[model samples]
Target chain A: MTTQASSTAIDAEAAGTVPRLSLNRWTFRTTPVQEFLEATTSRGIEAVGLWRQDVEEVGLDALRRRVDDAGLRVSSLCRGGFLTASAEADRAAALDDNRRAIDETAALGAPTLVMVVGGVDRADKDIVGARARVTEAITELAPYAEQRGVSLSLEPMHPMFAADRAVLSTIDQALDIAEASGSSAVGVVVDTYHVWWDPSLERAVQRAAASDRLLAYQVCDWNLPLAAEPLHSRGYMGDGFIDFPAITRMIAATGFTGDIEVEIFNENVWATPAEESARIIAERYQELVLPYA
Target chain B: MTTQASSTAIDAEAAGTVPRLSLNRWTFRTTPVQEFLEATTSRGIEAVGLWRQDVEEVGLDALRRRVDDAGLRVSSLCRGGFLTASAEADRAAALDDNRRAIDETAALGAPTLVMVVGGVDRADKDIVGARARVTEAITELAPYAEQRGVSLSLEPMHPMFAADRAVLSTIDQALDIAEASGSSAVGVVVDTYHVWWDPSLERAVQRAAASDRLLAYQVCDWNLPLAAEPLHSRGYMGDGFIDFPAITRMIAATGFTGDIEVEIFNENVWATPAEESARIIAERYQELVLPYA
Candidate 1:
């Protein structure tokens, strides 16, 4: 299956046609949405993964019209969930926000709403409990997401972010949450930058596929020094240590044909012009992912 | 088994005896070994994990005598292996140095020589190749180490260190090398700080125990950001996000009765007096690890 897809992708590239690629908004956070859309459309890249704040900034109605006019594909919305908080009010607010985010994602025609199941919120230090809370929040939100035709993709951020970002640090853990949610609407996002270091990653990806839980496959490289602050230091594809081809092959083996999204959170890259970064990302995607699509 | 051990530990501690703890040399790199040892002894800690460079500074012979005079136990030796260099000359030099380290570890009666199998030589992007080189290096050195009654403990660093520090980044990966080397002398060192983030860690620890592959069990916490440079910034147990007691319980469940060595590499902790650091580490271990033995 992967070979056939790769051949088709190669044929398309040879014919001077661009293959599918999703630009994660975090990569162009420095640029205004209007400028970003203009740049993306100019480059002939049609798909984008929008962040909630980005949508709010552009006004959802205006953003929707711009996306439609540009013929852009909404791959997946950038976020929802920090749902595992200590305060009941905060947790409830998060769920309400997520429900609205799901509605926004549906309005944008995004197939998936990415969720970062959050970290420990109390002094109790119960990671398992935090994970349980995440599972509960997802269960509560899944029916609404399904009704809105939006899949919820639980992105297990890197273990480095386990404290403040996402306690679900592995695909297996995310899949477990999906299973407990009792909704196929809830699935797992396989991000190379976050999970490439996992010894059981291949098996976990296969498990996600077998369980019909694979929602999104994001790509980026694991840079050295690992960065003192993980929020910003992601390496561009092929520029760091991760073997992108090997990892992408594993994701493909899972029968995951989801958009190969480029989600880099590098301060250096974000500071550059959105068009330049987008072009570089698209070009690298062509070089690294197209051949093995 | 863990419950029984914890009870025994509690009884021992209540009797006003000092806990058996080992100081990892990296924690005191800023201090002279003689001064560090003097401080540790003054504080009532009796065991030390020595670094090869520190041994060189004091002269191995003089160092051995100082340890003996101080009645200090050499728990383990800090390292031996950058065995993945691109050049054969460098690889051979690494092995030769490892051989010297084995001899020194034997002289000091340190039971295990920890190995940080070095990362990919920039010219070689093949992680599999680097791993193979590390395996061959271990195989070559295992017999010599066994003959000297010095076991080789392959310490799989955190995956964040996979690019530049050690290609062996999981306990399972380390166990594979030990199994292939076919030398009981070649085993794994399970460090909670590095492996706690691993979702498969519990299963890995159990497998390590079943295979009698555990050589040393080190304790520390996984701090956020993972430090762009992992040589420093390890969190003290109980101060960070890791479920230390749970991990210790998992290790103890394996029926492995190895010493639980405190191997923190935090800059803030190190800048303080070594005696104070050791006391704090001891206290944390008692609060965290001792609960699970």
Candidate 2:
């Protein structure tokens, strides 16, 4: 027993020697998946947050092989919700696809599968109804996700996206749904760029930690002039006004010891080489986040 | 007593006949104050929201006379805070100016004076401190406002303005300060363009109403392809996807039977004759808010 315990302690120590910081795939969406992986690996990043399209193009087997060969961890999968389909068939298909995504995340050895509960379809003016549908869909999908050994992370996007992207706009709102869903398997992603402006942020973070609903912490900066095309205009970390160290301290206060994922959706960053972006992010993680550790 | 009661009822009915819509002076920043008011009053607008600059240019007394002669209600005076100054002298100056503004609002018979608590001075990184300064300034000036019978409306602007404009970004946050200040004179202005995107909006509105913290309800639209300059790019009602009728219904649910002020700060609207702009907003308000009513 002592020998086994010592071996475990040594393994833990080895693991601690190399810190993990995740690079969200959207940061380099302009690059091919294989190239991105190769570049990121070259920069000594051991973890990645991937998108569905990237996996689809590379094929799951190829992705699995690449991740394994490069000794990389799949922190979280990019997306799988858009659950606001107008038709029953469409909604059913979206759910089925989400289940598949859960399977994929589990297959890739990722713990959390991200969900972006889609906005009201153009013809639908009932935002409340749309939100209800999102909650129901997640409730239904929770069992499947649990069965696959994957946690579902619902991302409440910025309020600007309430009409067309994701109806969930605040962490507290997301937590309400997560609590009502009655599943520890379903949780939420706390993205700084989307929620840094929320006045209830500290309270929400504490609540999320207390509920064990904080599945991931995604980092990015809030640009000075929020772009007309909000999806592509996210600022890179340290480039904009968000208090990152403060957020990290808040997250840590919750006893959350998880991967601090860098998620930028900047057009300028996306257009750059994946390796350069990964290196920049990794360097920032060390400079900004290391002190907290 | 019965005759007086009957007369009051008759006056209320007459006031109710004209839909309560006020043009925020910032909407016509480019136009001369006299021309703006003259055009708006001629277009049958019953109320106007004035700015300090507008009052200053036209001379507050002259503007007051013009409003009286035109039989227009000064729904709200545009602004009075900018209280987040670095130095004691600057802070004192802001408070003194706000006192003058309170006097002006009283002269114009404006029920509310809008307060946009300014952001941190560029060199300062203390937003929380700036907010503290704003609270202190407001507290100092609240007595003057109360004596003059002018309610000080704290306008919590959108989060995009957290750095350069108002630090208060949520209705709940504003209400907390309003309650803390121990002054009924200080309340909040609920602007649709700013607060519509808040996920906890309904609850915030209800809370504000319950506490009698709702001093004003301003209306405008959130346009997609958010204009090049967001500060002045608000859309007119029905032009954007904001659920106006639903929001108005929520506001009414709060038992806030206040003026539905039409405060659109749009470059498109402001560039035109103020009368045309006021007419357009009045028509939109009637079309959108009346249905909800």
For this target, which candidate reaches the highest TM-score against the unseen true structure? 1
DockQ (Cα-based) per candidate?
A: 0.46, 0.45
In the range A116-184, model 1's lDDT, one tens digit per residue, is 888876477667778778989999999999999999999988776777888889888889889999998
Model 1, docking class: acceptable
Instruction: Please provide, for model 2 over B13-81, each residue's C-alpha lDDT reduced to its tens digit, 9 standing for 90 to 100.
Output: 466543566777777787877777777766656677888886777888898898888777888998888
Choose the strongest candidate by DockQ. 1
What lDDT tens digits, residue by residue, belong to model 1 across residues B27-128? 777888888788767766678889889787888889999999988888899888789886889888998999999998999889999998998666646677
Give lDDT per model, in order: 0.82, 0.79
What is the TM-score of each predicted model, taking all chains together?
0.91, 0.90
DockQ of 1: 0.46
What is the C-alpha local distance difference test score of candidate 1?
A: 0.82
Please, what are the lDDT tens digits per residue for candidate 2 over residues A1-293?
12322342345335543265777878888887778888777776678898888778889988889889888889999788999877999999999899889989998999999999998666646677788888899899998988889999999887768778898888988898898888999888999888876777889999998999988998887776666676765777667766667777788789887777888887789777777787788766665554453
lDDT of 2 at B217: 90
